[model samples]
Target: MWRNVRRPWTAGRLYEETLEAAMASRPVDAEARLSSPPRASILLDAEVQPMGPLAPAEDIRTDPATWDPRLERAYYDGDLRAGEAVLELYSRGVDVSRIQRAFSVGAFGLSRLRRMVPTRWSITAVDDIISARLRERIKTYDWIPEHRVYSLEAMGNRWVVLMSPGVWTYESIEAWYPGTTWNPTEDVAFVGDWEGPLGRVGYAGMGGCYYAARLAVTEALERERRQARVLVLREIHRDQLMPLGVWLVRESVRAALRGRPARFDTLEEALEEAGRHLDLPLRFWLRVSETLGGGRQETLSRYL
Candidate 1:
């Protein structure tokens, strides 16, 4: 796959692999140096530069005839901020993925403030911004009538979304099995983050996957005009040996939520249903979950 990369490097070739490979090949002095990590290049040399404004290609002119009218206006306007542009685009029925791509290439935001953003950061930024606005609107909606559990398994991962009757609150938990992409040790690793009615203040410990899954869950609630305390539990199996982008979390959770969820009369029954699809026991999940415990007004159970 290295030879099949589209970009042609004048100096030499490039190799693309999972992050696990890069970490394994790290030099002994990588931790001691203040500079960047040693790149895993074979017969190739490259230069690194500080963050700076990006220059667009000369021939890439905007065609008014084929562009969305609002996005076109945002492109030339010098006053609209990036966050406002994103919300407007979404209201116009634009796809989030399309917005992310345009934002990456400096197509949105004030003309003077535009700069190319790394694809990874731009994805999370757009997701977080749009979802934050959605959360505000969802707060006014009624809570779901009952506990619901939605489950899906794909790409060597199992996803379970447990939505309980309550106000707008959310949490995302991930259990990476040994030999998986992020967990290389003999023991399974559990990490999670949560937000209450007031919303979270900083970046989640689980990183972009938290925002990505939250975006999907909130979109579902917005559609039905309902709110709930959402808990997303993911089990990353050993088969998931590579680190794919956060899109996996967003799209897979969206697909799971779209399916018919098993309804339950009580929170206990919902957790029992969700436990069947995952490899781990429910007690282990509760040990690390704050949203399920009592992050909101009501506690699901007194699990210790």
Candidate 2:
């Protein structure tokens, strides 16, 4: 006889349910999961700017004494359940930078099995959660009126954002240099898993960089109160010698969005405009781009 085994929920579903619960009421279950004694408040009620620089991980680790006792206890008890509670605090206006630091020190997840998550992992987790929440809002908005191409360069990384007037879709393409973090020898490229209007089925294989870029682009669309089919191309040059963490990807994309993009009448025109600024040829980027390359003939058919 075979016993039935229930399948676990996807991270996205868990995130949505957790967020819904947090918005509706205090997360009592999250609190119950905590192993440590409860405190009056896990996060203090303080006003903080929405976006700010991330503190170095070393700084957070070296000064664990400064961490909030209540939040620390919550993490020790509930693990990811505690993280949900922290997200609730964030919704109530606590500083994100502070919450990120707390997570870095192993203060957000399971208490009994608590261990410091690498800074990169912590950062990405936060980005994914926050962006997932943001996506819920942006999906209700209108689409852009025209195609637009935005580009920027920082720390030897070049970023190009191609926005198509359509339902919300996002894809990120990363081209790693020979000596860069993921590619230590010959140049290589990878496309993050695509997400349609309804959202992604699984985590992006490229990891944190994908979430960071998604968050940045989502913020731009939200600001305009308009959605789009967004394709982000990131090219890493040998000059970037070392891994600067996902923060670089987040900030650089954010910076590009802040600037005015060159407008175009069509996707091909936008790609042509974006190509002028990239280190690699437009053909190379399109070849590796799932959104643009594989589907190009079909996409161009309507125009032709």
Q: Residue 195 deviation, candidate 1, in Å?
A: 0.2
Question: Model 1, range 1-304, lDDT digits (tens) per residue?
Answer: 2222222111131211111122121212211112344444432111111223333222121212345555666666768899998898888887777777667656666665566566667788999999999999999999999999999999899999999899888999999999876677999899999998889888887778888898999899999999999999999998764667787889999999999999999887888899899999888898888866655224445544
lDDT of 1 at 139: 95
Steric overlap count per candidate: 0, 5
Cα RMSD to the true fold for all candidates: 11.1, 12.3
Q: For candidate 1, what is the lDDT?
A: 0.75
Q: Model 2: residues >4 Å from true position, as ranges? A: 1-80, 92-97, 109-116, 298-304
Write model 2 residue lDDT over 144-217, tens digit each, in one string: 88999899988788889999988788899888867765675664655466787788778778777888889899
Lowest-lDDT window of 10 residues in candidate 2? 55-64
Model 1 clashing residue pairs (backbone): none
